[model samples]
Target: MRMVKVEASVSLRRDLDTGTEMQRDAVDNIITQVIEQGDHALYTLTKTLDGAELDQLRVTEAEMEAAYAQMDEELIGALREAMTNIRDFHQRQLRQSWLTTKEDGTILGQQITALDSVGVYVPGGKAAYPSSIMMNVIPAQVAGVKRIVMVSPPQADGSLPAGVLVTASELGVEEIYKVGGAQAVAALAYGTESITPVDKITGPGNIYVALAKRAVFGKVDIDMIAGPSEIVVLADETGDPGYIAADLLSQAEHDERASAVLVTTSNELAEQVSVEVEKQLALLPRKDIAAASIRDYGVIYVARDIAEAIHVVNELAPEHLELLTKEPMNLVGKIRHAGAIFVGSYSSEPVGDYFAGPNHVLPTNGTARFSSPLNVDDFIKKSSIIAYSKEALEANGSKISALARLEGLEAHARAIDIRLEGNK
Candidate 1:
């Protein structure tokens, strides 16, 4: 890890929001094919890209049963437990439609409506994440969306992973599709003969999937254009070096583009964490990937004090922020930016990733500065409610007409004028 002094001039090496030209071109081609050829394009691309030949786009009932029969009770129980925790957490985020009436009978409020349908894309083949399934699906369910369709890449044998299948089955998500990548995003955006179009799409995928989501965003609502995973450890002298090292590696091992940074006030602790990270990397099976991530994107900043460390944190606006200092909670309110904040050594990043109640699908790179973690809000839409009574309109119609005429919208002014005349 490179050590740098905390300063206002410090900036990250990569600007993840900017898409590469290659990625944009690939996404354009993939989206074009899916829109033109529909399912045929999906099958051909799946064979070439995912190395799988599928007879159909939907997962069979027998496959679901076989997956459940193969998995042991322990993993099933754990999935259920995790599902319960996630459901409970998201249920709190469920909001109801509300209205307010003024003295003049003008009714103003919001109408919160769950989307009619949603599509969730989960990456498959070598990287199967059952926990992510829970995180993405459960919230849409909590929002009471009528239909939730799940799409994932299949193995060479044309089989979805047992754990992924069983987890979805337990969650009562029956509309599972055997597809992945940009094509899957297209199918969700514009319906194929086999699959119905969804109102929104939510989940994390590779660069191609992210690009596809960006391409289809206006046609169908998207959660966010997620970038590579990132984490920042804000610690002081009282923090444990080993814990800090382990937490950093947990995100670094995600992939080469992942970032793991540490902003601390103590120079001694920074050196100790560097040594501990090197020691732990040697023991990891994916040490090469983790090491590359640490080498390229990792940083350990030496701050003058806790205030300077917090300043660095706010400037970075990391996805996962861990306050491993002596007084973690006392520092919580001071943090203005972060997708999710992990307080204390025990509240590690992985807890929020897997078991804890909060959704793990968070804003990546520096998006935490403006965005939020995936939650029930992503699964629903809000429509503004405006109801003006006859008396209220009579009182305000002249002002409304004047403003409309001033804006050079004659039709808008006439609409109000005509309504007022009819009421008279």
Candidate 2:
């Protein structure tokens, strides 16, 4: 990490402009094939990419039970604890159908309903994230999603990761599939012979999986098209370099494309954090990946003041924003963009990613400017409710018809016109 003191305008543009067209095109191609050819295309792609030969894609009950028995008690307990916290948080986000009636006999409100079935795609191969399983499934369960189906690729031994299986079992997810990548996405998007098509799909994977979700968006509802994870640390002279360095590396270790940026007012803190990152990188198991991420996408910008740092963060609209200033709370009102905000030194990004009672599936690559973190709202739909008595319609029908005719929607006008004439 190199430390460079630049004005806020330049730093903002540079950080916000990190977009990749090549990656988008690659993901689009995979989605097109999955939609065009369906299961046959999925099978060929899975074999070519995952290097696994599969006769069946869905994981049997026998496999899930074996996975539960294989795991140690201590790890199982930890997963359960994480699930409890996640469930408790998402439970608060649940919305019930509501209605309101006016004195004139006009009734209006919204009916909130959970999806009948939802699919959660867990990454397979070296990236077996059980944390992701808990994050994706718990919210849907809280929102009363009828059935939750999970999918991940198999290991070389043809078994799913112990943690993945254990988490699924703990969360009451019986529909686990061995399929992965764009093919698994296809199975979830369009019902295959074995796997049942879900009403919606939510989870994270590589570019292929993301593209598949984008392609099948209309066919089945999906969570956001997630890009690489990123973290922006806004610190001052009071911030600890060690803590800042660790938090930045936490996201960088996710992938080579993952970004970690430190924007600070103090030159000394910036330089100290750079050294701390180097020292900490040497101790991490995924040092090569972290190092590559830091070398390519990581940046440390020294601003003239704390206000400048905040300005840069707002423009970038980072997925994760960590405020490590002397008074982190004071800066809360200043933030207008960020999928999730972590205040103070103790509130690190990982806390929310795992144990904290908040959704970790956040918007990435500057999408936070317009998007939000996943929550119960993502798993449910809202329909507006409207009812009007004859008197209420008689009072407002002519205005409605006038507005409709002004827009040249004669049918809409006549619909109201018919109601008014009938009442008269």
Highest lDDT: which candidate? 1
lDDT of 1 by residue, 1-424 (tens): 9888855345443666546898789889988998889889989999999899899989999999899899999988988888898899999999999999999999999999999999999999887889889999999999989899999999998999999999999999999999999899999999888888999999888888888998899999999887778899999999999999999999999989889999999999999999999999999999999999999988999999999889888988888999999989999999999999999989999999889899999887677888999999888889999999999999999999999999999999999999999988
- Write out the backbone clash pairs for model 1: none
Question: What ranges in model 1 sit over 4 Å off?
Answer: 7-9, 17-22
- Note each model's CA RMSD in angstroms: 1.5, 2.7
Model 1, 227: alpha-carbon shift in Å? Answer: 1.1
Q: What are the lDDT scores of the predictions, listed in order?
A: 0.91, 0.85
* Candidate 2 global Cα RMSD: 2.7
TM-score of each: 0.97, 0.92
Worst 10 residues of 2 by lDDT: 10-19
Model 1 alpha-carbon miss at residue 372, Å: 0.6
